[model samples]
Target chain A: MIPVLGGSGPVIPSFGSGSSCEQNNGWWCTDWLREHWGDTLQPALVQHIELVAIAIAAGFLIASVLAIAGFRYRLLDVPVGGFADFLYTIPSIALFQLLVPFTGLTVLTVEIALTSYTLFVLYRNMVAGLRGVPEDALEAARGMGLTRVQTFFRVELPLASPAVLAGLRIATVSTVSIATVAAFVVPKGLGEPIFIGLDQNLFKTEILAAGGLAILLALAADVALAWFARAVTPWSRA
Target chain B: MSVLADQFTAHTFVDAFRFIGDNASLMLSKTGQTCELAFAALGIALALALPLGLWLGHRHRGLFLALGVSTLGRALPIIVLIAFGLTVLGVGFWNNTAALVVLGIPPILTNAYFAVDGADRDAVEAARGMGLTERQVLLRIELPLGLPLIVAGVRISAVFVIASATIAAIAGGGGLGDIIVNQASYGLAGVIAGSLCVSAVALLTALALGLVHRAVSRSTTARA
Candidate 1:
């Protein structure tokens, strides 16, 4: 029988009747959620966070180095930018599967795919942000007898903070969403519950809960990063 | 041992190609389905979003709405949307199409709004000064000037829809994703081949749209 919400409501015990809900394939069961919160949901949330964090952190580091290098050697910019764009074009699922032969069905494969996806956004932003630093500011730093490295750190880096953080914000939120797909291979993260629910006759409660959490996490990360960007770049506010 | 390992690795690549060749009709059909799903979603999203965005932009209003819709759209995962659709809409083509439409809307809407809104205000004023009707001002001045950004939004939406369409298989919708997800039936080579096809399609879509963007921008600039 196709399970319809409230279809079996009058016959079955309501609310905390977890067994009935499970049997009838009810839309949501709060009792099942409460039971699984500790063992299932929490760990999945934690893993989701870990996956996003590691992917963004690694992506930032790599993109930063590439962006800086591309800036220093203008000749390198085209190729590096092109490469990142190429990587960005590959869909997450395809990228994940493409790596499975080399890395197997491990977290490493997932991370590699996730990290590659971030490179385009992070690299493009970093390059644009750094290049966007005002010539006057650079001149002032040079006139102050600051070394190139010192000038970059004090003047250019601060000026570029807004763009860099904007990139981070975008990358972080996107990675959060993409990392859910990672669960297909590695069986970790919020996606774990989502796929589990899908496999188990479309468990509406689990899918909704996990999917809701993923969306919330993305928005939270976006807001936090936006605030952090504004905080770091006080001059921009003025 | 090293030689044998090298041969084995080489064989896997060759095997993947052979698999694709063997399943040429199946892969092509799946790819066609993917394109159909993506385009249908894009078309619906455009029909819905463009008028709203254009009207808002013409009036120079609702900046927050445009940006908010986009940000929220990006933050919402396609997989989650599909899963949600499955619960409410049930498994099938419509569910997948609806999820993909949500995916396609934001970029196009925001871009359309911003493109028109950010058009050369002086040109808009001049058009008004020349006694062009409001419709003429919008169609001739704002839209033409904003064509590049609007097209960019379309391009972004197209790529996103195409990529996310792969997950339609999870919702009992057919696409190359069917091959990727059904690894037991399709084998490792088939899975890899499916992924390769998806990547190729995505890259090609991006490239083709990019050329269109360039051509449109160039014509717009030449006219100016």
Candidate 2:
């Protein structure tokens, strides 16, 4: 029976074995991974990466355009922020349920929701970075006879790289995490194994392996973006 | 698009509203549970984060520790944490609350550290010049000045916790998620109703906290 909000009787807590992957005999069995790796982990990882990349790339493009336009029309600021905030407030499961009926549990459905989540983080930071360009720096660019276009590309954008990249780092890491929920809509990613393992009582190995991989993916993405940010903003180091 | 449109049809709208009315008590109870879960987690987080954050911020020590905690907090997915809690610690309120408290800590700690550490140097120097004791300066001066951003941090954590409490339903922790996940049996109307309730609660919480944050910041600035 579905547990109603005010159901009668005390709710019983279910227990699963308390085992760590490092100490557990389950995940430590190389034979188990070897058997499952080809069909399970590899494809799931690939799909996970694909979903994250598409969402982040699309989010970045949309946020960049919106941020640029926001600079032109100050009126866009509050509405854009409000819309993003509204989207951010929606629960992930509710979001998936709402979209699935329309988009039919496809990657597009997942991407739409995922991309929307990124807008709040990306748009806010990008705008802040753009607006944060020093007035003196702008004056110098104008004094040097740089056109509005040249100054934007050469001065404003480069100066804003740190903030924008920080946003990108945040968006990318979060995307990796939220993308796990994609397993509910479509049979893809580490989430598939994790959820399946949970439902089937397949022990700690599947859950640990998939969850650990997702965490590792987030860490790796964050580090890579940090390195990229440093590479692009060499003057910050100077 | 049709499905989205279908959801707002007069029949569905009536059904949704009626469902909400019929389940009003249950809805309120569930919302209460979600609120309890969030506040309990927040309380635990504040207890741990406040002292640590204040001490470090006051001493200006362990900037790296602050950064490291924030990074780990972001990188650790809540779902993953819940899954770990369920499997490792066994499914109960304690495990679920532990996971949420972990989720709530980073923002509180990071913002508190930033607030106290970044308090106006000149004002702090003046306080010191007046022969104010360290404890007095922190309690009387720094705490009041840092209150706004600290509240802002709590606002962030609060919103996050409220929205995330829905997931607690999955682990037998009871929230609106129980209704949400059972949409198959209750029909789309029930799902929509639950979704609306969750959204309303989350948005209202955020709005309320945001107002408080604004009020605090405004008063703090007015004093300055």
- What value does the lDDT take at residue B2 in candidate 1? 5
DockQ of each: 0.34, 0.32
Candidate number of the best DockQ: 1
* TM-score versus the correct structure, for each prediction: 0.90, 0.88
Q: After superposition, how far is residue A202 of candidate 2 from its true place, in Å?
A: 5.4
Q: Compared with the true structure, what per-residue lDDT tens digits does model 1 show for residues A1-238?
A: 6566767455553543446656677878898889899999999999999999999999999999999999999999999998887787666776776677678778898899999989988999999999999999999998999999999899988899888988898899889998999988888999989988887778888999999999999999988887887787877861
lDDT of 1 by residue, B17-74 (tens): 8988998899899999988998899899999999889989999999989978987887
Model 1 TM-score on chain A: 0.89
True C-alpha contacts between chains kept, each model in order: 0.44, 0.36
Candidate 2 docking category? acceptable
> Which DockQ value does candidate 2 get?
0.32
C-alpha displacement of B114 in model 2, angstroms? 1.8
Model 2: per-residue Cα lDDT over A21-80, one tens digit each: 324536345655677788888898899999999999999999999999887688998899
